[model samples]
Target chain A: MRLVLLIFSFCDWLQRTPVASYMRASFWAFPLVESLHILCGNVPLLVATSILSARLAGWGLREVPVSKLARGLLPWAWTGFLIQVITGLLLFSSAAAKYASTRIFPLKMLLILLAGTNALIFMRTTYRRVAAWDTAEVPPLGARFAGVVSLLLWSSVLVMGRVLNSAVSLVVAAHLWFAR
Target chain B: MPDFLSWCQWLESTPMSATLRDSLWLFPAIETVHLFGIVALVGSTSILDLRLMGFTLAGTPVPKLARRVLPWAWLGFGIQAATGFFLFAAEASRVYLNPAFRFKMLMLVAAGLNALLFHVMTSRSAAQWEGRSTTPMSAKIAGLSSLALWFAIVIAGRMIAYFE
Candidate 1:
């Protein structure tokens, strides 16, 4: 209950802030911000997951050790993940109550959390043993599992994002009909 | 040109377009698929471009990386093209006239040309620098151009909604 109250107060405060109003009122701000968010947010996730998964599956990157590839690619992934959070929060703040009501919104957050947890686990467990199979064509079972999980979770997050739009529109339409 | 736009208007008025425009689920669902294609296409191209630019995966041969990644890139482009057609068909008139849409189409053309020129000019002799730490200047230029053009296409694509 306290958590819910804290959320409500935080959202209320966010809605009253200057940034939220500006985002909502501006004609191009929302779409442009959303563009940046999706591009920066999902692209890295896709790229990192795809390449890492391929490396894990022994599909490519045979010459370079897996550790080197991961090291090189992870900075971009981190950059993207950070951008997503910032832009996503701004977008959400512009319509907090509306977004909070949408089912897909929570699912999207959950997916992101799951993806993050999966990455952390991978880093801690399979990735710690990188020296053993760094150049092996097929990575060990755990690393492969983490790669696949990351891919699936991120993909679902994309789907959830798209669905959020539909869910919001449906809710709005229903509200209009009921009010009439 | 008027005739072409008129044809677009006609296309937009079709039942299929109605479903895409009016049905909330269908539009976003198709758009999600479109995003998937973008991820696949752009994601793959970006990696290959980075490799060409001598940024990452230095141990992997250029030709080998290209051979692995380009197919996925092409597949993504193909998916985008198919889904894009459906999307354009749904809002043909609006998209036909939108400046952002026009910009996106132009950038896509530029991207295509850049890819083709790279393939014909630079990539033909990829074997010479395949394992080298640094690529030739021409390869670097092509890689840089590809990176810039594809990202421009992405920005232009996202602007379509705001402009419309």
Candidate 2:
């Protein structure tokens, strides 16, 4: 837990410090980066969803060999996640002081932590067993569980990301209104 | 101007329905969960959807991809179904009244019933189209509807807030 806090603190710092001023100077690129992140986020979401619906009808990936499908989609999702993190940091850096004091900041951290943890578990527990599920002619419950967890967590992360800005604004608005 | 949507607002805020109003945060959180679930869902589904739209995996059999990825997809759908019910629970009255919500439900039903129809139609056709990289026109239509209806469902889901 301490280690997790420590890492988040460091991220909190970089996101605040604008330590690499050059990154901050490249401010014009933020929207482009963010849009790319949105694209990455949306496309995979579409694909991953339909797959789940088909499966519930008692079909496993082996029949259609979706193991590689897992492999195929991970990179896209990861790439999108990476872009969000980078640009997110950049946005944070541009206005570090304000966010540092905001409750919204911490909430973002908790959600990001969940996303990262979900990703790690996904690769280790779920992605690791694709071939075995294919070879054994049985879908491993562990992998399925991991898949379920991943689906839930990433969905949270995306919504959290989308709402983070608005939420912060809303909090600020409520604060200001209440203060008056 | 929008009488129905205004009715939705009244329902959401009914003092007698404090139980529902007090619980807005919970459903949104569940939605957050559903959001992630769909990520995994789309990841698995797109492979098959695209396959239905005629993109084939090299060497690996079509059934094989379907078998492997479908669980991940349905796992998402399952999470969605569970969470979806909660979201409705949170604002059941409002959702029941909103036009966008109605359309969303219609699209969901369309997607669901179409999915069942596709399965029945395709399973019979499986022997003929089975393992073939390219799907028949009907299967492609199924693929298209699956994609389109879900797209509408998501957009409506997202837009329900805005429209209301």
Candidate 3:
């Protein structure tokens, strides 16, 4: 109710900003930013996270200590995450209201939130005990569980993000069919 | 060129292409899979590239890392090729004419050649430098060029949509 209204108003305000206007007006800005988002942002973050998660699950790289793998990969993951945040904000600003209204966009955001939460919980809990099983062929149950959930949630986020564009077309087609 | 264009036209007319183009869900589904393939392909390759450049994972032997990581890269490549072929089939003629698509194909070839040349020339001496902190100059060159080409391929692939 009030929260939804606040969100919509915020989106409207965002869409009216100069950054949004510039994003819309410049022919190359949107696409170029999107390319950067996909290449440097989403890909690296997903890859680094996936590798870490896979190791946590005792899937591969069993020889490398979990702490060492995390040390090496977390920087890449953070860099990618930073790029994603900047580019995502730029993209959202371009059509904030429309994106806010889209079902897929909200869903994508929710999944990302969940993924982040999963990572945090894992870090605070099982990951704190990583030294006990850092090089184990099979990690503890908590670590493996966290790894699997993280993988699924992040993959869903990716799917939802990619489907955002096509989902709009599907909605339009449904609307047209109903109108006819 | 004319023959290639005709072949593209023929591909566009095929029933499979028509089905993919007409269906809203199928194309997006395949495209999502294609994105996953890119993640796996580029992700695994980048790990190895960073290692070869002595930037990260310096302690791991080159052969050991390659043996572990290259399988995933090959798997990703298989997924990319299969999905990419279907995607190309869906809009063969238009994509054939697309400059971005053409550039992406060129980069893919270049990336492939770089990998092959590295395997043939640089990696042949893996016995000599497998555990060294710094890789040979040729390996570093191959790694850097590969990273550049793949990133270029990703950009070009994204541009195909905007160009269209």
- Model 2 chain A worst lDDT window (10 residues): A49-58
Residue-level lDDT of model 3, residues A102-139, one tens digit each, is 98998898998998999999999988987899889879
Candidate 1 on B16-90: residue-level lDDT in tens? Answer: 988888885677888899999988998889888888888877777888878888898989999999999988998
DockQ of the two-chain complex in candidate 3:
0.71
Error of 3 at B18 (Å): 0.9
List the lowest-lDDT window of 10 residues for candidate 3 chain B: B122-131
The order of the candidates by lDDT, greatest first, is 3, 1, 2
User: What ranking of all candidate models by DockQ puts the best one first?
Assistant: 3, 1, 2
Off by over 4 Å in 1: A57-64, A169-180
Two-chain DockQ for each candidate model: 0.66, 0.15, 0.71
The clash count of every prediction, one per candidate, is 0, 41, 0
* Per-residue lDDT of model 1, residues A74-127, tens digit only: 888888888888998998889787888677787899988999899899889989
Query: What RMSD, rounded to one decimal, does every model reach?
Result: 2.7, 8.0, 2.6
How well does candidate 2 score on lDDT at residue A146? 49
The TM-score leader among the candidates is 3
**Predictions ranked by TM-score, top down?**
3, 1, 2
Which candidate number has the best lDDT?
A: 3
Ten-residue stretch with the least lDDT total in model 1 chain B: B122-131
